[model samples]
Target: MREITGKQITDAIKKLVIEANYKLDDALIKKFKESIEKEKSETGKRILEQIIENAEIAKDGVYPLCQDTGASVIFAYVGEEIVFKENGNGESILVSAINKGVSESYVEGYLRKSIVRDPFDRVNTKNNTPAMIVTEIVTGDKMKLVYMTKGGGCENMSLLKVLAPAAGLEGVKQFVVDTVENAHANPCPPVFVGVGVGGDFEKCAYLAKKALMRGINEKNPNPFYAEMEEDLLERINKTGVGPQGFGGTITAIAVHVEAFPCHIASLPVAVNIDCHSHRHKEIIL
Candidate 1:
């Protein structure tokens, strides 16, 4: 069995937090450039150009792309064969590491500390502690970590609906298109649409969020789903919501879907939207 220290995890998490917020992923940048070229509406093209410039400024200035640095969400895949040693305190080593990472990154990166400790009192944590962690045990020996800084605007726009089994593919398509159209400029246009279908309600939400981590230009492997993605994008852009909802042709950059089996009577669907500044990173150790 492989033994991994908590400090290593903490260090890696800190690095990922800094890097992800500062650097725009190449795939996302490339998609923005392509969108600029293909955008027919002059207003849409101008907005796309500004998006590209914003990314460049964030990278050069080593600043966050958006003011809402977002709550730190960490997804960990720990191998069953690996053992994690707990520190002297009873606190979970994993949780401690994540907190350490969040604290260091928020300070060093100059990210806004948006997390509040009490909903009633609205007390600020000051350092952005208590990261939202989701852990899974797998068969492999290596640990994989994905850091997702999910902003409130797009996250609040997420929606879920339980459709009758008979609703099938057509229902799913309508729901997705309708959700985007209703969102309008709220979620920040030129958004990435993440659709999760067929799972239980909660599972569907998880899958939808996971879909946001996929590379921007990468097509879904399943041809049927890929076609659905294409169709959904076409319909969403037809709304003319354009960049930042200023009115244009490029409403969304990509539509990514993840699916799973569900009960015979139910078809649960979830839609998670990521804004133009979609930010996430993965690390394997």
Candidate 2:
């Protein structure tokens, strides 16, 4: 069995959190360029252009792409064949190491500390500790970490609905489009939408967030869902929310849909939105 040390995990997380905040994903950059060409509104085109420029400046790592450095979100795929060494502390070594890395990255990298100690008390966490980590066990000996700096603005606009199973596919489409329409500039226009269909309430929300992890250009492997993604993208852009909701031809860069089996009696749907920044990255260790 392969043995992975806590230090190794800490170092990896630190690098990933820093890198994701500084450099926008290549796929998203390409999409922005394409959208700039397609945008009919002069103001919308200018907004997209400025967004691209901001990304370029942040690539130097001296500054972040947005003021809201965002909460640290991690999806960890741990290989069953790999053994993680304990740190001798009572706490879980893996979780401790991950949080340590996150704290160091935010503090040392000069990223803003946006996390709070409690939802209501609103005291700042200072170092952005206790990252939102979701771990899954997989077959190989290597560990994979998918990281995203999820800003609050877009996250706040996400929604979930437990539609009647009778609501069906059309119902799902309507909910997603209406959610975007209701959000408008609040979620940051030209958003990237992630839709989760089926599953229970919580699982549906998770699925929607995972859908955002897919590459901007990547289509769902299942052709049925892939077609649905395309249809939703078209309908969303047609909302005329435009870039930053200024009114334009492209309101959304892409719509990604993920689905799972659910009880016959329930149809749970969720929508997770990400603003233009769309900061995310993946690494294997």
Deviation (Å) of 212 in candidate 1 = 0.6
Q: How much lDDT does each candidate structure score?
A: 0.87, 0.92
Could you give candidate 2's per-residue lDDT for residues 1-285 as a string of tens digits? 899998998999998898889999877888899999999999999999999999999999898988898999999999999999878888887899999999999999989999989999999989997799999899989999899999999999999999999999999999999999889998777899999999999999999999999888899999999999999999998889999999998889999999999998999999999999898888898
Q: List the residue pairs that clash in candidate 2.
A: none
Q: lDDT winner among the candidates? A: 2
Extract clashing residue pairs from model 1.
Answer: none
Query: Per-residue CA lDDT of candidate 1, range 169-280, in tens?
Result: 9898899988988898998888999999988988999889888888777778999989998998999889888888888888899999999999999999999998898889
Query: Candidates' TM-scores?
Result: 0.96, 0.98
Misplaced by over 4 Å in model 1 are: none
